[model samples]
Target: MRVLKRLVFWMFGFATLILVTPVEALEKHPLNYVDPFIGTDGTGHVFPGAVVPFGMVAPGPDMEDRGWSYSSGYQYQGRSILGFSNTHISGAGIGELGDVLLQPSSGTKWTRKTVNFRSSFDKVTEKASPGYYAVTLKDHGVRVELTAGQRVAIQRYRFDRSGKVQVLLDLQHGILFGDGPRVLKSEVKTDAVRGEISGTVWSKNWVEREASFIVRFSRPISNVITLPARPGDRAPRLILEFDLRQSRALEARIALSTVDVAGARANLAAFGQPRFDVVVQSARSQWSTLLQRIEIEGSDREKRIFYSALYRTLIHPSDIADVDGRVRGPTGQVIKAETGHYYSTLSLWDTFRGVHPLFTLIVPERVDGMIQTMLEHHRAQGYLPLWTAWGRETWTMIGNPALPVIADAVAKGFQGFDKAEALAAMIATSTDPRPNAPAWAQRDWRAYEEFGYLPYDLNEGEAVSKTLEYGIGDDAVARVARHLGKHEIGKRFEVRAAGYRHLFDPSTQTMRARNKAGGWRTPFDPLVPTSPMNNPGDYTEANAWQYTATPALHDVDGFRALVGGSSGLSRWLDRFFSLPSLGDNKHLGQEALIGQYAHGNEPSHHIAWLYAYSDTPERGYEMIERIARTFYSDRPDGIIGNDDCGQMSAWYVFANLGFYPVEAASGRFTLGRPLVSKAKLHLANGTVLLVERLDMKDVELNGRVISEPTIDYKSIMVGGRLSFPHFTAQVPKAN
Candidate 1:
């Protein structure tokens, strides 16, 4: 009987050990949970490639097809490989930057056209991770592996049954959508003795830019043949042949720079003679370190989705500065970065809402550098970037969104940047107009200063949307101005920020377009989505319903008053989601709709969180839960829309943690439902914040019960524990 008791006790002890072990310890490495292909299909538009976090060299396979779907150059549905390019913009609506293409062929004839050298690959053989991508070309039996450093792309090719292997270096290749950028000029130099190929290509795409690259090969080159440019192609191509009679494997390190080929050479020399495996390991380590910041306890699928979303969040605002801190300024002049690091790929209109706020929490080190880069942009271009890539302004989206980012940094108390200079840049960007700016970029400062709001008749289009957006920017400037003790500037911009109230129509209970004379525009349809590019309605990529709640970010109390108090606001929200969606329109940025709430675009991202101000705060949590469950998954088509340089993914990361930056520059995060059972936030200030869902409505910060539905950035930074003690066991059903 004693022996039986001992056996039972031992079994119970072993069970306890298994149950008590941390989920993170029992599972695979954080890097293993990241699925790079999650957003590669449908409208996700993210690339499945080898890239270090915010690396300049996103080396990936470029597809044969050239259009909207191939924005990242690689789509999950694509079957053919048109070589690999060293640079690509991930999750961009407009495609560009597929520079320095290298394709390996095992044919007897030398081909001039890219189609002749293109090879089809099977999906089963293709594999990708955080920093590594590999695929086998079936036609030529050549295996391609790609990896990257911050500025260099490392490629390895293994030829099966090899005799003579050739690599085509196509200088004219780039991702072409509607009227995409083409090669304006190009120059190539080959050195057979040194086994190096260096060149520069000047192209006019989303922006006119130049990229310089130097390719250093591990094997000796047998011959160099320059291919003539095809019809309508200006830049030339080169075919480098290697005698693979003795060896079957070849490796090439391609370094890129915006400054010059000399800069590219310097970039290459920075990481001296590192093997492909070493670079891959280094990239994996870097991703693991960043992913380790937020640890959660959840199912394998949940972890995969969560970590994959986290992976996408760190991919952009790429390090554009070379190793020596030399970068091409916004006005196309070579300049040295003051901070030794300069970043581009600023999708401010989209990212300032969620991505930048997330950065302040987990990656505070990068925030200053990004702000510095924006300040430099204002100095060079006379305005902050609307949307920029590779150190040049694209002027793609609407609004003065950079203000929010700078203001958020200041409000968070990050002292790495110059506060006065940042305030000046924000004021200039908001109030000043550039002479050489595009018509769309010139936001009619004269009319705005005179009338307080951008009138429909005066502005080109998107007048209502621009007015709302400008009001948000003005609010951001006012916050910074007040913080800096500039009382007059603060009060002036504060009044300007309230300009959104003028367009609010109480009769229709929706924001209406008005002319400069304060007369409402005729034939107002609230449900119709609008854009400045195509459907020239008053909205920007959204309908009237989405913008209804946008102003709430700045002044929740004022917005509540405008919409007839808290209960009325709640009822309006209920109607907003209950109404049937117009339909899916990718071009209009309307998809993944919960009624009129377009989760696919940036405008609707924060509307659900506004439930905090309503009578039914649980309603907001319910909607958040539904959105997370319905729109996100672990599949290739997991994301509802373009990641938009990680904004979409950042939203998921914030929502999963049970809060979101409703007003990105406000320094306060509104509480919602916590998706994860528990989350551990390793803050940049060396404090760890533990967030857990308990069985009550009141939230506790480090054992202190908080009555409010919001928490400030200072509280999170000086972290301990944030407990959400209120939630249903199952997802609350929508009323």
Candidate 2:
């Protein structure tokens, strides 16, 4: 009865509830289960701000310090908010773009100190939904509500008493480059008749770009106060003081554009000036419609965590192009999207693992757009993008991540992308020696051609990481070629995909860096963890034990053989998970450790599935189940590590869904013990894939028992029922 009463209360206040008894209750909409604050407290770095799915504008609060904890611009532990900004990065290790801040204040003297004008708020008064956030400012006795459209952020401020209220637009406020972004151009002008403040800000921190925005208010302003500044200089702020004597509520609609101020105006015009409640309703509708693609049956807590993770997966690889398809290219040229909407902020090194695969499942239309964008980038530059921001290839992380994504799309029979052009791009990236590009951007094809792998002594790079990633890329290329019936290209790259073997050291039974003389680097400590980037002789953000388990996606049989067959591999995995750490000096920031397996990082992402190739498949199930339960939650500090632009959240989404993609482009997903009782995947092809867990060792597809536990992309896309009769953690012999 107590549970029933709480459910009733939750239905009215928290959820979109339907009246029914507990035994006959209907599953809640996925949007109703999302908790935006899950990753805001810990090192998860996810901002609990308002954003539409794949929307460019992530409007949220910014803290005083742009330190590691506040990388996303908002931390749950923060006591006060400096201001609300229009742009925010979600779950990234680096910080950028808290651009165009607006603070609502009452009785504020003109002061440059942010602390003086800041407002403190209690967590109890704060509320966040899919596309809305609200909090009561204790200092100003005002209630601020935030909601966003595709390109606009609407803020509604409700004051307790009617008086003169000021809205401060601070152009100098940003969360990048230590304190603030370097302003290259700033212009803030007011149209008194229209009650609008228009501005253009060109700034450079992580990436140099331009943003033009317009702020329109509900009431006319009595005074326009531009803060004092030196001669021939742009002031950082513009204060609009309005006499609220006639009304107690004030609203501001802000729109951003990467092109020009006119573009911003056009965006605002297209969004329509709906009332705050209507806008909030529209935002909620959008989220509810998008999140309804997947249906899962679980407890309230499980549903909350699952939907929150699903929300995070759609936040990045943002749509950077405007409604007119006009965007700034890599070289700052005004490029127009010829085919579809061009997107930016591709964290390929992290996202290629799980996030993109999720896209291929439910949002294949967006996948087509991403491929078109990548091809456009290749046309603009010489090669595909590594990690892009604002259409500029940042070369942030290692590997040709774009290859696997494109290959995966092609393998799944996703159309509207040119396969021949994609193959040419892949070959060009692999063989072409980009002399002018940075060392990090250019994959050393000459070293690869000569040594078959990235030799530590020969290349100035993280040898093991480069070697493993290149092999994965090669395998992806081969899969795409074969899928297109280009057998020659497939066979050629199939041999190249075996290059990971060159790094395998039989004596140590782990992948190690080989010197110019083909000898293992002395002091080869497989158990001792080191930063893969800093300790560059062998790894990148991981040690030998972790890197050795990689590239198994395409060659698990060969990998098992190299580790002395299934029994030997099983023994090594046991050692890898049992030992906590080698020495007292634990690697800082390398977290979510299970033995040498670093779940916090991307390289070890596929390790949990490798045990399926061993004799002890049950061990893999137990490890995965433990990881799913221990490493995630629905609290403010729910996530265990940096979400890595939704990659961490993507892992959770897959692990809880009963399967995961082991290979990026293989078009196959390996099975694991399902965490939920049942799930229905609504695919883009207008078909539903149903999964039900039963207590048995055998599996079935559409009522026909299957020999293998894996499911192919074609099977999932075609849509049918998949059943697991039983899930148990008992060791069994390999099939």
Candidate 3:
């Protein structure tokens, strides 16, 4: 009897303990789960820097190596630290924008070579969170802490021993990729009375543009030494000396603008006398607010990967407008952004597939601003941006990629931008000839209009890829036209959208290149890949097998009929994935292979989810699970390929939520298996959406069973619970 009473007492005490524990104590702040270094190594090409979400200035360490791997100016494998730069490009294949290099050194004299000032740091002392990064310089015994506001980079240098300190400013410093220095013209001026130094650098790299910068110091400058430019140097360097005997620390604020030095000064003044720790806290708070929008139930590792990807998706299409709303337009003229801001760094080809759709759900406010920016670019340049960075068109990628993003916004009922003007811009970009066209843009639109497709003989290269991409763009234009009640224009583009059928060869069951004489090109191989840079083949960064299965999101029934029935389409997909990948000669864009399905590239991103169009969505679930398990992790080399300004990460984010936007402009998302057991989407519409995976086959939205294989965007935005069955009924929720 006594032992039984003790057992009851123990059970009672345990239940009481559980009841008293606060629920908030069990959860961690979203910022704690983000690891900024996940994509810093391997082919990820992402920078582990200190910058707010969509901020203009990203300050990070530039490594000794300036190769393709260091496109973001920092590589995990590199050991030595070149000076930190105020601007950087995140996850770009081509390196550019390493401007305004600053190095805090113990040496007082200016060396002719900048390499002498480089320091070696141990990896153990390196630390990074969302908005803060810190490292210890081994040679000088100084600790470097970096933080940022929207347009300013706050840097704090703490010395172990106080004496003399010299900060070197290289006006000509910029990222290079085997091409020589990019600085065309640069000039600098120092004001000892104001404790400020300002400069302008006009560089021609990925895109030719001018950047102005101003640097403000916390302490008065003791002296300034100017280093003469060598015979081959483009600009002079300056060394500012500071006596740190009184204090062992120094702080500097660096602000940048595409307008002019006055704009840079205005940007600097916007953040008045910012304390380093206070700025760091504010940045963290901003990240936390965005990250908390989606709450999920998963393991620690899962949370780390999810939040890290979420962190990267918010890094680009950065806000480049100054505090006074002044911005440099595409023509290099100062223009005032009527929307109070302007955004740049548009990687449209990769982003239109997933990134913009994701933005409409959680961050709808930024969508209007981005659309306005594109419209502004269209006004300055003749067409929408193919690939842009720093308010300049690079003409890097092919096709009209921006149309789908705008059309998707219109279809989703976003009212922030002028829809009729957006439709006109899309039509003009599609039909009008661009000025000073690049080689890829020099195609004969007359022939395309006559033949309903771009012929391999008439077009320079990427004949099949361009035809299919143009068809997709036309479909987007048609969708917007129809929504705006322009029935005639919608009908015209609908006919043009079906032009992809002309290139589909029924014999090989693939998209084959055709000549102007209406004959198929010879020497065709479905398995062999092609690239625009190396071999100007029929496809762009892909092969026939991948392009043939391109998700016809605009017309599912027509694509199914062309491929055979649903069973035939499923068989084609099975064969596509079951076949072996091409050998080492495959294009660099093709990586992270699952059979022939390349998750590393954008063209194949929607293919895995294409299984939903067939009878077997279970197969797509299997592929998505395999991809998430194999390609992503919490390490430095986690990402399998370039983040491509967040498209790759956006794919993972949507896939994890159990659905994907197969057609970005179609307002429909096909279902897939959910990775997390439960997720809460805190949408911008002031409603909470709860998604859960249960032991059932039918999907339920707000407790009502969904009969179709897809869900529309409106239903998701309305804010309700969406429940899906587990891939296997026996499988339990992730702990």
Candidate 4:
């Protein structure tokens, strides 16, 4: 009996050991239950805002453009929100406005001055899913819920706080930086605007939006808000609110339809018909799936904020319909409901920098929807959208960056849109260096697509810098076209690919802009960033020097030339980032620091990856590893810039995986330092791809020389294919 008992005990011990219970029993998966308040407390960079997957705009808070460029969403600064607009810029950098604004106000006349609606009494709870957001405005004693379909917005506002409340609507609101308007219409209730909306930014692309309501408050407001008789004499924005009491229960359902307003309302009435609790539950479940995709072991606070930020990304494209998926389009014309789904409101310039890219990783299927929307907008409006707010494409930035976005998607193997149509769009957009062009104009980058260099006369950008940096996207498009069997087109692109040297000036030893006569600009300052035709040098949001090392075309080879030779280039790059700043005004807004590296923006997101493209793979690993451990933390200070949708996070996810997409739309990735050692991608294909960062210790966070490096990382894919620098694996001879 004693021997048998000993044997049983030994068996039990063995089982327990093999179970491998780490420090924690995985008590909560990263996505199990997440608090939605972490990112809402600061720059409000991450809005607890709501929308559909890959939506164009989101209806949430606006800080009146007080913070950074993308602060158009909910801001952490204010107490009473102005109102929710049908159009909003997503993941932007310099910030602007869209069309269709509506706000809940107390007194009669709609005021442009911000109203103070602070409440010591209640709190707001916002739960966001793939296509919706719900919030209970506590002080107002109201429960408000919202959702987006494809192009419409539906709002359900419940009144209870005061018992006798009014729901106000204002249409005279939109945020524009310089000479433009954020608002197109300002009125109370209407028959068709049905609370209709329409307009465009300086960009020439047109937009349209509408809002409708189905109030089922516990009680109705005895007093109605005083609004204007005609919208002509007023600012084109919307302002109105519903009043209620605190003790009573109020519930509302909002839906969005990319088809039309009625369709939007219908979609809301249908899909959103589930009990409020049910909708909330569904949203939570969806969030669970997205968050669970990547489980991180971290503190409770970090998890809350991380989950909250992820939720914020889904705020746009809110439910806009009842059940049939019908929503209003930008023309204010009610259209048939989307067969699948339609989404709107994309601040492409800003999001293209990060947010959209991040979505490509988490929700790739939605990418096709988002990309098609941009193309459709191009067909309807003439030019590709810049700061697409709600349905209006508010012209903000310079480049029609959808090129890069489409290229990236194609490279990642995403589908849903017609590839031929997409290719047609890309090839058309290849040239015509005019300040702006019709949507279908730039079919192909004119001469030498690969080597197309930006002339210094463009006045903006690191003109010459954009020439080099932009080649990557051109090459990316060419790669996809070639893969699709357009070899003739590919051959042409291959030759143009090396044309990045057209702007190179050996005298200045940097990429300089060439004039029509092939002469380099005499006065140049790479550090002084400027924009097109503007009285500046450099590029938009950054300096010329900052964009110089942008090895978008092909890093390994590009670096070789910039430094004169591979060996010399490797040493120079190592020491270059370690040097001090030439100190220019380039440090504006999110352009915070400069050690010859813009930790504040996007162009440098891949700067550290340059080392991996070099012969000293060890140096690349060390730099990336150190940066991951330093710049990215699980704290409020965790992000270096406005999460710019998901660009910042994508950079984190990529570097952590030990590789980052060198060009936004390229199939290539340059190895970099990684945060985690190993990760697996759950691709659409049945195949599961694994990435191992090997060992990356001895990282130099403070830019100090790396005294030690544990890993030798060359720019290679997880599949073991050499990316650039032309390293070939020779077959070993049999012994």
What clash pairs does model 1 have? 181-204, 181-205, 696-725, 696-726
Candidate 4 or 3, higher TM-score? 3
Candidate 1 residue runs with Cα over 4 Å from true position = 1-27, 112-115, 729-735
Which of the two candidates, 2 or 3, achieves a greater TM-score against the reference? 3
lDDT of each: 0.87, 0.79, 0.83, 0.49
Candidate with top TM-score is 1
Where is the poorest 10-residue window by lDDT in model 2?
Answer: 14-23
The superposed Cα distance between candidate 3 and the true structure at residue 444, in angstroms, equals 5.3
TM-scores across all candidates?
0.95, 0.92, 0.94, 0.73
Clash counts per candidate, in order, are: 4, 9, 0, 124
Please tell me which model should have the higher lDDT, number 1 or number 3.
1
Mark the 10 consecutive residues where model 3 has the least summed lDDT: 726-735
lDDT of 3 by residue, 1-735 (tens): 654474456445544543575757423756789999998888889989898999999999998426787789888877788788888878878787887888887646455454477889999999999889999989767899999999999889998777788888887778875565777888788887666889888888878899999998877788888777755577767888888776889888999999999999999888888689889877876787678788889988999999999989999988999999888887788888879778888899889988899998878878999998889888888777788878888888777889999998898888888898899999988888765676767433677788999989988888898888887788999999999999999999999889889988888888999998999989898888888887779888888887876537567667888988788879878988898987544244678887888877888888878788788878888888788878888999888788999998998898789998888888888888788999999886467899999988699999899988789999998998999997842322222
Global lDDT of model 2: 0.79
